[model samples]
Target: MLRCPNCNTHDIGRVGTNQFYCWGCFIELTVNDGKISSIHQVEEDGSLSSLNDLFLGDGEQDSISL
Candidate 1:
């Protein structure tokens, strides 16, 4: 099961082919090759702000089995 790297919760919902939204932390996650490639925060204006640094750190990637 895919879990949110931010909230560590399993309350992630698929928003697209490889995109997922985390209800626990209100963040969007993009998966590639069964790994978390990017993360974003859903702003009130419906804009996305990158949260990769906060979650994955500088140039690092997190693994998540599809």
Candidate 2:
């Protein structure tokens, strides 16, 4: 069970090998080395926008999900 970093909810769906979609906040997360290295938002047009600056913590030091 993975927890969403944005909404802190354990409602994540695996969309790729290391990518996950957070239903809680509708954000996409990329996991590397057990940490969230990238953040993106799924837009209405099905485009992805970077949300790194807003939700990214110490990527290597912070664990955002399972």
Candidate 3:
């Protein structure tokens, strides 16, 4: 089970082929090659705000098993 990096919850829902939405923290997670490539916060206006800097470190993506 994939847990949200922000909330550490398993309440993740698939929004796309590799995109997932975290119900726990309301963040969006994008996966590539079985790793979390990007993370974004869904704004009230439905815009995506990058949260990669806060989660990923120095351009490094976090690894996760699908």
Model 3 is weakest, by summed lDDT over 10 consecutive residues, at 57-66
Clashes per model (N, Cα, C within 3 A)? 0, 0, 0
Off by over 4 Å in 2: 57-61
- For each candidate, what TM-score against the reference? 0.91, 0.83, 0.94
- lDDT by residue (1-66, candidate 1, tens digit) is 898887899998999999999998899999999888899999999999998888888777887788
Q: Write the per-residue lDDT of candidate 3 for residues 1-66, one digit (tens) a residue.
A: 798999999999999999999998899999999899999999999999999889998888778987
Better of 2 and 3 by TM-score: 3
**Model 1 CA lDDT for position 42:** 100
lDDT of 2 by residue, 12-62 (tens): 899999899988889998888887889899999999999887776554435
- TM-score of the candidate numbered 3? 0.94
Worst 10 residues of 1 by lDDT: 57-66
